[model samples]
Target: MTDPGAYPNPGQHPSPHGQPPRNKRRVWPWLVIGVPVLLFGACGVAVVASVAGGNDTTVTTGPGDGDAADGGAADRGPDFPGKLDDDTAAPAGATITRDELAYTVSPLEAVDTVLGSYLCSTVTIDNVGTSQNDFNGYTDWSLQDTGGAIRDATFGPDRPMLNSGQIAPGGRATGSVCFDDRTGAAPGTYVVLFEDTFSLSTDRLAWITTL
Candidate 1:
């Protein structure tokens, strides 16, 4: 107020009517910006941590992984490794054993002899029948490829045929079934079939599964 061109003294500026100005540090700027910035950074970190810790992985079943069924020709509701009796035709009195056998199929990831492109799986068969019948891994089982091509079952030299002259009733057999997709095991649905004998009827066991 004394001199309009003079600058104010340090920390004490001239106020209106010649009053002294109050001394105060500049902090409101930092409080306004810094507090929100810190909160935003914390929330961002929390979101990243939640995403990293969440279990988002899925275990996919490859061509021949997991349970194998004995589905009929088409995917007629759970035709995998289960009973294959023809409900339509049973031997009059004995209830015609139909296909009283059950099978489990597990995919074989890598095999020494199996071609790199070929798909392989292990089959476990449980014969619940009362009679002793033969089991042939190769001639008994079959695979349907993505293109609807039927591939015959075969094994490497080490893979033994799941057989004995007598897979007695209640007997179990294990064998390996390999398939050549011709185009490799592409992504799609494949069907596995099993029959004690290669008969042309849908009475055999069939399973529909994805690759």
Candidate 2:
């Protein structure tokens, strides 16, 4: 005969209030614990790997091994030709003397249509001296327009006296000569002459004409 406390027969249903059989109970306890533990372990490994990699990195400093030298080398370069050195003392050259001052009407001259005036020709003075000298003198300047009429020329202050009254030996003074075109002078060659105030040299002359 079967014992009364024994499990129910395979064909019989369980009592309404009784618990289910042991093997039939849900077996998710290990899954619940192991899944979280595995995830935590993976996260810990990732953090540790990140920290270890960061510590292994190195930062290099200072100039690159192939870099060129500093700019100090260029600062010690060659000196100017006429400049004086600290230990060397030399006197300046002789005083500049003016021989002849002459100018020609440059081909680059232009006329202002709005102002109805001709731009004065560019006058170039040649230094016919053998040694360095200074220039100090004044001369009246004149300009000829397109017509045969002659007119006086005026200078702007910006083009102050050449060399401030001092011309280096063999150096020439050059400035613009501005004049009005109202003289009805035809576009042609113009003569420029100067009377030196210093030595009363009346023969100093130069010429230039319009193209």
Candidate 3:
């Protein structure tokens, strides 16, 4: 004794499949028949999308901003210090022979994956200052790519940064700094940027190099 109008009145609008509308069919058998089919349909769609590599899912998939065709020539390396020398202890690398301090980046290596890609190098800071020089290893360096992306040194399990400490006059400190690499359209050149102080300025030391 069911009130058809108050419940699922299939007599008014029958399901296209001729099955009772779920609300009208409030029966355990119907629930058991419906739930798994719904789950299976959802799973099937997800599987097909993944296999097709479709970006329909929540995770994003697309090119980065720097993926321009001109090889990031616009984002080329920063300017090297005017005092930098072409030949130094590391002929294949760069040396900034300035008045107060001499900074060197050498033993450069191109690292792979790294959660991505990046340029790896050891930086040496020599204090030619009149007094002891305080140095924060990573603060003294930056990496710029051809795409105009300026990156700071990354320190993690993937790459450990140099220790920050003080160097007496004529003393030197060495540490590692990494600049993240962008894939896709980019120029072959990159610039190593450095500043000896906490203040910001256009006069930071730079070394133009390639990867």
Candidate 4:
């Protein structure tokens, strides 16, 4: 028989000085793979943290911001409620004046229409500006009830509608502005808000009266 102790067993190697046989597998290959896996895990965690931080960012706006004074409706912020909030409430028949423009609104009157019923109010717009200004009754006026509900002007009534045209300096125009008569004949608190889009002023006029 061949010399049995001359070579070690399969998958093992002899050690010096008759020490235990060593396994053939080397640890370097496992170390190379494990190192790359650890690095990729750390990079994934960092990417997730960065995305989470970006989602936490926020933006805010205030009254004194230049958006209101600078540009048209497109420049306004999403929270802009079509009118400014600082306008004080004036009683009916009171002349509330804005930049070079004066306004007077009368009490509400009920009118029946074939399409529907409506509440009408007479408004007088006096242009005291140095230059001529245009007033559009359809887009310039709105009414708010005590419940914070806003109503736009409706042309379904029989009364003479507000004149929409250019007014020269030191001139005035008068006519009726009507709204859907949601509240019955009993008078309810109403607020009339007027914003002259033709003028550069962002300020609006508000009149509080019974409808």
**RMSD vs true structure, all candidates:** 21.2, 31.5, 19.1, 15.9
User: What's model 4's lDDT at 107?
Assistant: 73
Going through the candidates in order, what is the number of backbone clashes in each?
Answer: 14, 14, 4, 0
Residue-wise lDDT of candidate 3 within 1-211, one digit each (tens)? 6466665534665568977566655699989999999999999998776445411111001224232111112322233323233211112244554445556676446777647766777877778668886777666677766666777877633665666888899898887777665543254666666655653222445555654
- How far residue 210's Cα lies from its native spot in candidate 2, in Å, is 4.7
Q: List the residue pairs that clash in candidate 3.
A: 71-187, 75-146, 75-148, 113-116
Of the candidates shown, which would achieve the greatest TM-score relative to the real structure? 4
Question: Order of candidates by lDDT, top first?
Answer: 4, 3, 1, 2
TM-score, candidate number 4? 0.55
Candidate 1 Cα errors over 4 Å, as ranges:
1-75, 78-98, 107-116, 157-164, 198-201
Q: Tally clashing residue pairs in candidate 1.
A: 14
- Expressed as tens digits, the lDDT of each residue in 1-211 for candidate 4 is 6466766566454566769765589999999999999999999998777544412111112224322221222322222223454343455666655555566788777788778777778988888778897787778888876566787877845677895898899999989988887765455577777766654444556666664
* Per-model TM against the reference: 0.47, 0.37, 0.49, 0.55
What's the candidate order when arranged by decreasing TM-score? Answer: 4, 3, 1, 2
lDDT of 2: 0.40
Q: How close is candidate 2 to the true structure, as a TM-score?
A: 0.37
Stretches of candidate 4 exceeding 4 Å from the true structure: 1-84, 185-187, 198-202
lDDT of 1 by residue, 5-55 (tens): 466555445687887666688999999999999999999998777545522
Task: List the global CA lDDT of all models.
Answer: 0.53, 0.40, 0.56, 0.64
Better of 1 and 3 by TM-score: 3
